[model samples]
Target: MRRSGQNRFPEVDALRGCAVVMMLLYHMLFDLVFFGNLKMNLFSPFWRGYVLSGASLFVGLAGLSLTLSFSRERKHRNVVPFSKYLKRGLLLLFYGMVITLVTYLALPESYVRFGVLHCIGTSVILAYPFIPRPWLSLLGGLGSIVAGYFLSLKIFPFSFLLFLGLKPPRFSTLDYFPLFPWFGVVLLGIFAGNFLYPGGERGFTLPNIPAFPFRGLAFLGRHSLTIYLFHQPVILGLLFLLGLIRFPL
Candidate 1:
């Protein structure tokens, strides 16, 4: 659409933006429940699917983009390219730590352990080589969900595997993606991306955009990384400063 090298897929970016938007909404809702202002039991097994779904969408897109990043028609690698991915991953790890620090400072008893960003970030680095393979990625991604589901129903030293989205247990982290299942989703995306866009001048067909809104979604998509890292903090700050927090401290 915008020349080969500068070939930006509006659809993918839009999807990432959408994921970020959903993430904010989900996290915000959780905050409400955590503060006890909301009536819903956000963590009930019946409703937990909603949280996992948002995570699935986000990771699926990450897989999809892995393919886009290597389009042959495209030039100009990312600013730091692979390193940037690594850096983003580490940044998330650090952010997770910082969250623990803040929570420990505030609500020490229920601090966040392994949130989505940490899972996503860890996957980014681990997902590199796998991006080149499709079948493997699919198996791994779907495997995560299956594993987590089954693992959650049991209890044993082996049960902790599910929290990693592999084996399963009753124990829950503040936000857990577990390397097993989430990585599988990412792998599935990689597989899709590879099958769709296998590099070179003539790779991957772009579908026709039929009347979908574009510019705004594209901007959100482009800035999704920044949005993910900051949206909640900004919103939480706003709530705190505005005295809208009703957690009944």
Candidate 2:
């Protein structure tokens, strides 16, 4: 997944590839249900675990990538600039907003209010200030995890803070990844990246593996954002052509 002219960590891209594969499988199952080709509860423990684990992997990898990028920039320039991160985060947020509009138009009853893209973008922006302070970032991450856990146990009257993991009464969403616990995961990744990678270079050498199959996976991982943006529509379109685009509505 290393760009031709940029610094990259191959292992990170491979891990991202793994996460994306899992995500694709999960979404395929979801589409099967949407098209009445499956009759299983997606909220079942197996599905829930699968989804959460994949999300965690992706978020953690994102944090790791941030640290690497920051380190590379800092090496060339004495100070790390915030503009690049801000631009990328806002761009992702815009894409998330597009998803929201599309879902609202297509499936208003269960549209995405705040999904993975929103969480990642928001987390990147919010976590930027803490990246330079690994210890503080660790504490913040732990705190968010604990706070979100307890918060999830209680319900609120309003839904405004749903992005923060505050559950509102009778609320439902197609996808939700609140900042509380999930951002904490990102922080933890930052902590790990700082501790392990130190200056963004691996502390230890890794054996060079053949790039035949792994490179193929890395390609998918590198373009994951673009793939995510279009995969659902592609899946649905294929299903529609196969006479499987059934919906209760």
Candidate maximizing TM-score: 2
Misplaced by over 4 Å in model 1 are: 1-7, 41-47, 71-88, 157-172, 200-213, 240-243, 247-249
**lDDT against the true structure, each candidate:** 0.67, 0.85
Cα lDDT of model 1 by residue, 133-176, tens digit: 67777777777768766755656665434437543334544556
lDDT of 2 by residue, 86-177 (tens): 98899989999999999999889889999999999988888888887889889999999898899889999988899999988887788888
Provide the lowest-lDDT 10-residue window in model 2: 1-10
Candidate 2 TM-score, C-alpha based:
0.93
Model 2 scores what on Cα lDDT? 0.85
